[model samples]
Target: MVLDTVMTTLHVLTGALWVGSVVFVAGVVLPAALDGSLDAAPLETFADRLVYGSRAASVVMFLTGGHMAGTGYTFDLLLNSSRGHLVLAMLLLWLVLSALVEIGRSRLVEGLQEKRVRSPARNAMGVFRAAAVVGVLLLVDAGLLASDVALY
Candidate 1:
């Protein structure tokens, strides 16, 4: 029971870190870059941290989430219940958000490599916006699952 609690806490923290970072980058950093207020050097550094932080968080979330699912749910339960459906949706949303971050980061990196700002920031903003939306959905789905809200 204690182990489950620990795993759940870790899972939630990592999710928050991942979602928060993406939102910060999309809403704050990228906007600054697009407005010519930020330089490539700092942006590159931030992007590096964001990429690595995201990767570490992803691994932690995956392990913790798998542990939770393994301990609390069976294959049958995962496939047959509304809560299970939410879990599946969470997984899908995670994948989508991860991909969006990767793509956005790539665009930013490519632009930074050329010492350019506004173009890359503009290119990535749309993807990051989509990711933010999905991140919110993922959080909402988790909340619904936790609150025992029935969805059919």
Candidate 2:
């Protein structure tokens, strides 16, 4: 029981970190970049920091989520339960967000390293916006899963 609780807590906390970072990037960083309030070099540095933090949080969430699922849920429960469906959705969302952020980061870093005149900020902002939307959806799903009201 203690182990399960620990795993659940870790999973929630890590997930929150991942979601929060994405939202911040989308709501704050992207706008600043778009508005010229943030220069390319500073934007790139901020993105690097966000990527590093998000990557670490994603790994922790993945591990803890897997552990929680394995220890606390049966295959049947995972297939049939509302929480199971939410978990699956969250996993898919995580994958999409991770891929978008990593690819965007790589492209941005390459452009910056080459000292190209054109900035990748536009592309990065688009990616961050998409990820933020998905993150919000994941949060909604989590809230629904946690609530006592039946979803199905």
Candidate 3:
């Protein structure tokens, strides 16, 4: 029971951090940088700092979530139960989010490294928008999953 509680807490906290960071970067940081309100250097620096934390949180969430799923539900339950369906949806969302973050970051960093000063912001904005939309969707799915679990 204690282990379950701890894993649940970790899973929720890490998930929140991962999603919050993405939203902040996509909605606030990218816009500010593009508009010239925030300088590119500082924005890049801030993003660099966030990358490690975001990735770490993502990994932790995946690990804890997987552990919880494995221990709490059988394969039959996963396929047949409503909660299982929700979990599967959440998992798919998580995979997409992970891909978006990685691909976006890679493109952003590549542009930065290439010193594409004139276009990096514009390019990054597109990636940020894409990631942000997916992140928001993931958050909604998570909320629904939590609500379903609570009612269960």
Candidate that scores best on lDDT? 1
Angstrom error of the Cα, residue 137, model 2: value is 1.1
| Alpha-carbon shift of residue 134 in model 1 (angstroms) | 1.1
lDDT of each: 0.88, 0.77, 0.75
Best by TM-score: 1
Cα lDDT, model 3, residue 64: 95
Q: What lDDT is obtained when candidate 2 is compared to the true structure?
A: 0.77
Could you arrange the candidates by lDDT from highest to lowest? 1, 2, 3
What range of 10 consecutive residues in model 2 has the weakest lDDT sum? 111-120
- Which pairs in model 1 have colliding backbones? none
The residue pairs that clash in candidate 3, if any, are none
Quote model 1's TM-score: 0.96
Better of 1 and 2 by TM-score: 1
Clashes of each: 0, 0, 0
For each candidate, give its TM-score against the true structure.
0.96, 0.86, 0.86
**Candidate 1 residue lDDT tens string, 1-152:** 99999999989888988999999998999999999999998998898888888788878978998998898788988899997888888889988988888888898889898899999889889998998999889889889987889553
lDDT of 2 by residue, 83-128 (tens): 7787788788888888877876776666666544146666576777
